[model samples]
Target: MIDFDYLKREIKKEKVTSFLVYQKGNSIFEYYKNNKQLEKLHKINSCTKSVLSILVGIALEKKYLTSIHLPVYSFFTELFKEQMDSRKLDITIYHLLTMTDGLDFPEFGEWNSFAPMVYHPNIMKFVLERPILHPVGTHMNYNSGCSHILSAILQKVTNMKTEEFANKYLFKPLGIHEFYWYEDKMKINKGADGLVLKATDMIKIGQLILQQGVYANKRIVSEDWIKTSTAPYFKTYDSIGFYGMHWWVNKLDEKNDFNYENTYYFALGFGGQYIVILPKEEMVIVITSEIYENSLLPLKIIQKNILI
Candidate 1:
């Protein structure tokens, strides 16, 4: 059972804008400081990468792309030249999905830098032109530039804008209609950030994953994709836990006060937005917050109040 009173107190303390708990096919609890904010769109920062991962799965199911193993250069042939570093040609869709493209793009550690690519006029070129600092697919570097490259690849293969494809295959099917997706100057949806969705919509996304890519008896994406995408492929930052395709996986071995062990995966965004899927508990926890400096605060609150 969840301690709602304690949860509310903690949430209020953290200044979380919205909080939701869905379990066993029902939203067991919901809290919004301002009820009107329930339907308001909130920026879901890096969670956009998880959504793009879904779109990529759909594209694969539809045969728009043959395989994730396919070299990214095949899709973005125009971006490459004969004189370019041949190693860049080795980067695959899998590399981008896993954030191991190793393009010398740093977004974490003392090298907390993303403004260069974000502000560049030709963002795709800016990302691709970066020096390959590590061997492709061997090291996991937290890089949003790699996520943006995946968006560009999706657009190139689908022959439609990433947003259009998402609307057709993902959003509309999941009953998500009111939302906003920001695109780069090249018109590719920002796969790393800039997706605005309501807290309820965020819950829907979590539910979709919780239900193994099914929603309302409809198979929105393959179960294989769900398992594959959420499977932990690498250990990320201490706070972020393990990294999957574009998702974050965590396992809490030590039982909480209730003596319940927990293993879950989540879609995390900058500024405290999260869509946490707990398959064992059959629950989905959605949180959107304004705490920009401490994006993990919501997760900590959830752990203290619910997971414990």
Candidate 2:
């Protein structure tokens, strides 16, 4: 068994609310503090993007999305009120998924200053108006606007909202019945943030990824999609190492397939929400916190204790 007493002390020292661990198909450890409920439906923040990653996989398999290679603006041609940049047309769904859209969005984090683009009547338009700062596929920038456009793409292709399509396809199959994905005024679900799910359900997401996109013996998404999504497609400039579709990958050490590597690929949120999957260790860790700033504390815990 793991040491929850020490972890509880660390969690008490911080504003962390929930911590759950699953290994070998069992929930081996769990902890809560700050009067956090076991079934609390708190927003996972940008961790929501990773969920959208899974939905993209499902959409691909179901043919809701024609191809990640398709140009992003192709789906929303009717919404543009002004002439658009030719550079923007070069962006593809893969660029959005990988956050290489090169959109010069000043907005970084929610805690950052809100500009006109955010509060504008239409978010998709706001996102599109941002100047292309770099050549598409040549730079890596973390922008939520790309995620929102992706959500909009889901709506355009599926003719259903992001959350609705996810519920019908991704969430429902995994027995995730209780969850809420907040939307903007235009009824477009915030794809980059605003998904509220219980800690258990969040772990189920990690579990699904750990299980190769299968849940309860059912193939919710293809195993090939899981591999493709988690593969190290691009290496970020930061220490996060490589980025896969939307998943962060750490292929630092590998010996054999099952028992050799200590690598863990995870979904990270703005605050501290995480769904860390260690394929070698056979472990999945989910953490939710209120500490929006310096969210590295969770990663510290995972590194110093869990992964060690």
**Residue 305 in candidate 1 has what lDDT?**
74
TM-scores for all candidates?
Answer: 0.95, 0.92
* Model 2 C-alpha lDDT per residue in residues 1-308, reported as the tens digit of each score: 45778877877788788888888879888888745568789789888988999999989999988789998868887654363678888899999988888888655435262335457788888788888899999877777888888998998889999999999998889899999989888889988886999989998899999999998999899898888888776775455556778888775354433222755789988678899999877889999988876767787887767776
The positional error of residue 6 in candidate 2, measured at the CA in angstroms, is 2.6
Clashes counted in candidate 2 amount to: 0
Model 2 lDDT, full chain set? 0.82
By summed lDDT, which 10 consecutive residues of candidate 1 come out lowest? 253-262
- Against the true structure, candidate 1 has what lDDT? 0.86
Model 1 Cα shift for residue 79 (angstroms): 1.7
User: 1-308, model 1: which lDDT tens digit per residue?
Assistant: 78798788888887688999999879888889798787789999998889988988999999998999999888778887732789999999999999988788767865553446888887888888989899899889888888888888888888988888988999999899998989988888888997889889988899999888999999999999998998888886877788999999887663332112456889998888999988878899999888888888898887777765
